[model samples]
Target chain A: MDAITVAFAALYQFGDAFAFLVLSACGLAVIFGMMGVINLAHGEFIMCGAYVTVSGANAGLPLPLAILLGALVSAAVGALVERLVVRHLYERPLDTIVATWGLSLIATQGTLIVLGSTMGGIGTPLGSFQIGGYSYSVYRLVLFVMAIAVLAGLYALFNWTRFGVMARATIQVPHMAAALGVDTRSVYSLTFALGAGLAGLTGGLYAPTMTLVPTMGTTFIMEAFVTVVVGGADVFLGTAPAAVILAIVKSAMTSWQGQLFGQIGLLLAVIVVIRVLPKGISGFLLRERT
Target chain B: MSGKFVRGLRAVALTGTVLLGAGSAFAADPIKLGVLEDQSGDFAAATLGKVHAIQIAADEINKAGGIDGRPLELVIYDTQSDNTRYQEFMRRVLQRDKVDAVFAGFSSASREAYRPIVNQFDGLAFYNNQYEGGVCDANMIVTGAVPEQQFSTLIPYMMETYGKKVYTLAADYNFGQISAEWVRNIVKENGGEMVGEEFIPLGVSQFSQSIQNIQKAKPDFVVTLLVGTPQASYYEQAAAANVNLPMASSVNVGQGYEHKRFKPPSLKDMYVTTNYIEEVDTPASKAFVAKFKAAYPDEPYVNQEAENSYLAVYLYKQMVERAKSTKRDDLRAEIAKGDVCMDAPEGKVCLDPKSQHMSHTIYLAKVGADHSITFPKVWEDIKPYWLGEAGCDLTKSDPSEQYTPSNPPSKS
Candidate 1:
């Protein structure tokens, strides 16, 4: 392949991982990173979002509106779940893992029994465009753009907004925030809802590019977990850079060798990063500032 | 005290006498068979239809006065799409339920998992799903299309219609690996060249890199041996990328009814060769489809596995009647006799006495944008000789091994 072909291939590969990580982990980053509560049902939240989009679109709403509705539905569900179950186990992170895992099972099997195994998913909009001799899907590029926008939007929300500032403060010291009359309980619930809403948006955006099934979330969850863990507790700065690094490594490795080696390169990069940097790429960046 | 104890004993004796009388009132007990399937997980889409088809067949048999005045009873269990559960439930079906025969196992690995237990119990394990072929065992019967019947018919047609250069993508498993080998053989036999081949790990859904690589290679057509719910996403991804190359797969659309699940243009123009498709224009197939549709009005579609499952029940019934008993040893001997055959909805299906694989008709089908299948060519009674080619003759000797490719493709 020529240099331009190679470049385009690399770009597409990068986009693939970047989009996957950003969308899947953005929600997980908030729930796991900020709250220190392992939400094993994070993937199920995405699944719910996908289902919402399909149902909404089928129910005569426009596609974009359907996607927005999906996110809102997920947010509502996240809030309800937080109020009902997660609120009781705020300090118990391990317990949250077990609880969320059970929730995931119920969600998965319930979908299977209710919706049936195979439901038709929407087709990917936008046709393909050629770069040099290679053709690429416009939908894939849309995912990449969406991932960046989500990252930026998240950064602005957490860094600029009063709610973001209050959330960060609440997470840093719940008792202090509570004493300051900032209702730590509400903050936790809203933060979890925000995270879950992001996961829903991810699912709605991705529902078109893949076949939708009750078990579709399993495909995205592993990579999401890896990206989040490798990125560390700092949601925006950590997850963005982590996605980039992992995407580039995976894309390049896949192009050079094959799919198996590409995946190995990703896992190996994570292992090496977790071992060497302990606190992840963001931690190392923070320590450098000191 | 003596009078009270005697009165209690008399009551217990009366209860026992009534229970025994009720038990013997039914002239013959039902012939119990085990039905193991994945009802709620990854394999559910492909396997659930087969489970329902089994039920329909058993119900039909019982309605027809059953075999020798004995009703056919199915002890069904959902394996939950877990391979470990296959063995656990197989043990239950064999030892606990003590079923005469078993109709289970969707994937090749799942079959291998439960085969040992079935063999130990001398139980007849009937698998009805398209496979990579080359399995030689007397305790098991494969009533589904194999690579030999599928690729032998489809590959040459693909090569002729498209070109000699082919690219292969398969799931990274025993079935995928073995099936890819057969693709290589067929491509070579038909004077084609395999330009690129990749074995993808199961559940790796993202295929942008792989799609781009295929575009770079620029093969005339692609042969996908992908399996499972996740791997099916490749077609959607590929379609999105506008990789317009023709693709042939025996694995994808037909068995899982992927055509119905996926949006059009993704599966459109895709080629599939199988023993049965819902759109076969034959009178027998039409009648079967009508009955199946009436029976399962809500099912997405009655797939090849479902048809095979329906056939397996009748085939077993034939063997039972031939043996004149439901004993495992007698059933095995009857199966070995090689006189078992069924005029199934798919076509005439008969067991290859040597390999215990079914010999049936194969049809070449193309998927329309609307997910309707159209059969262009149908080959009748294509024996699964791929096992014979591998020097497996179970008629002469009982060998326990899965025959692999004689000349495997070189790892790139």
Candidate 2:
């Protein structure tokens, strides 16, 4: 292969990896990083999004509209979960983990019972373009763009909007925010819903490129969790940079060897990052700013 | 008490004893066939049809007055696609229920987990799924096609149809690994070169890197031994990337019915070699499909594994009738004679008595743009020649081992 072709391939691999890590961790950045709730059921929310999106698309809705419907439905479900289950366990962060974990199991098996094990998946839209002899998916590149859009949108929502201000205040100090007439309870619910919606968006976007199984969320869960852990609590400051670093490591390893080594290199990088920076990348960034 | 009362009691007692004796004399014991399959887990969708097929076979035999008036009773257990469950339930069916025989397992891992237990009880068991091959056990009967039957037909045809350069992507488990080995050897033997080979871990959905790698190698065609829901995504991703190279497999559409599950154009131009698919156009196959559909109105596809299991039940009934007994030793002896054959939906399939494996009629099927299947070639009576050549003669001795290309059996 020519050097130009090699460079394009390398760039494509990095972009794919970056998109994957960023999208998988985006929702968790809000729920776990911002809200201080460890949701083991995060994957199920993604599964829900994918299921709804595929069902909608099959029912004759346009693909983009189906994806939007997926995100909305997931947000509604997330809001309901916050009200019924998450509201009771906010003080006991550890208990919230167990509760959400139980919820995940029920949701997964329930989906299996209702929807069966497999569903007809939507075909990936858009065609492919070739660079030299190598061909690449236009849809995958779209995913890369989508990942960037989601991150930038989240940053704007939290930093620039009125709802974002109240949500942040509530997360930082629930009692103070409530005293200040912020309706802390409502903020909490909306924040959780936002997190879940982002997760659903992740699912809907990749639904076409994957086989729609009840357990398909697991494919994203590991990478999602790892990225979240390495990114730390700050979604804006940590998530984007962490994804870039990890993506670079993963793509380089994948290019040098294969996926197995790439995965090994990813986990090894996580361990090293955690050891050197205990609170994560965002924590380090926050410390540097101080 | 009056004399009339005493006479009445004695008569009643006599009638009761006679009725009990008549019941014992006329009605025979039901022959229990243990069925353990993945009915609710990862493989539930793919293997549920097999469980239903077994039911259909058993019901047909019972409807026909069974074997010499002994009803065929199914002792069914849903293993839930878990290996530990296979162990737990295999023991339950064998030791507790004392089932006459068993037709069980979907994956090779589950089979390996419980096959030893079946042997421990000296029970007759049939593993009815296409696998990596080279399992030679006296107490076991494998009705599924092996690498010898699958790859022998698939690799040469793929090479001739596509080109000399091949790329292989397989699941990391034994089935995929061994199958890939067969692909490599067969490709070389056919005077073709394997440009690249990669083993993908189970549950991985992303394939951009793998696709890019395949493109880099520029193989004329690809061989995918991918298993499970996640690996099935490779087709969709590859298609979207415009990798127009044709693909061939021994698994894929035959077992999982991927063509029916995935959208059109994803699986287009893919070829698979198998003993049965729902699309196989034969009177017997059509009848079987009709029966299966009638039994399960909502079932999407009647897969190859289901057909294997369905035929296995009938094969067992034939064995019992020939031996005139359901005893393990009697059936084993009858099987050793090597004349066991069943006219199944996939045409005539015979158990190779020497190796205790099946000889299947392999069909080469292609997926169209609309996801419809068409048979382009057929190889009849393809025997499990590899095991027999590797000295796996159950008639002479019981090896009770699975041999691979890396681990050949020691010639005695």
- Give the per-residue lDDT of model 2 (tens digit) for A1-290: 79998889999999999999999999988998888788999998999999999999999999999999999999999999999999988877779889999998788779887887789988999999999988999999999999999999989999999998999888877888888999988899999999999999999999999988878888898999889889887788879988998999999988778778888899999999889888884552232100
Query: lDDT per residue, candidate 1, B272-378, as tens digits?
Result: 99898787878988998888888888888778899999999898888888889887567767667876788988889888777889998998999887778888788
lDDT per residue as tens, model 2, B110-205: 989998998898888899999999998988899999999999899998888889999999988888889999999999999999899998887788
The estimated TM-scores of all candidates read: 0.94, 0.93
Residue B159 displacement in candidate 2 (angstroms): 1.4
Q: What's candidate 2's DockQ score?
A: 0.60
State in Å the error of residue B205, model 2: 0.6
TM-score of chain B of each: 0.91, 0.93
- Segments in model 1 whose C-alpha atoms lie over 4 Å from true places: A281-290, B1-26, B407-412
Model 2 docking tier (incorrect/acceptable/medium/high): medium
Show the colliding residue pairs in model 2: none
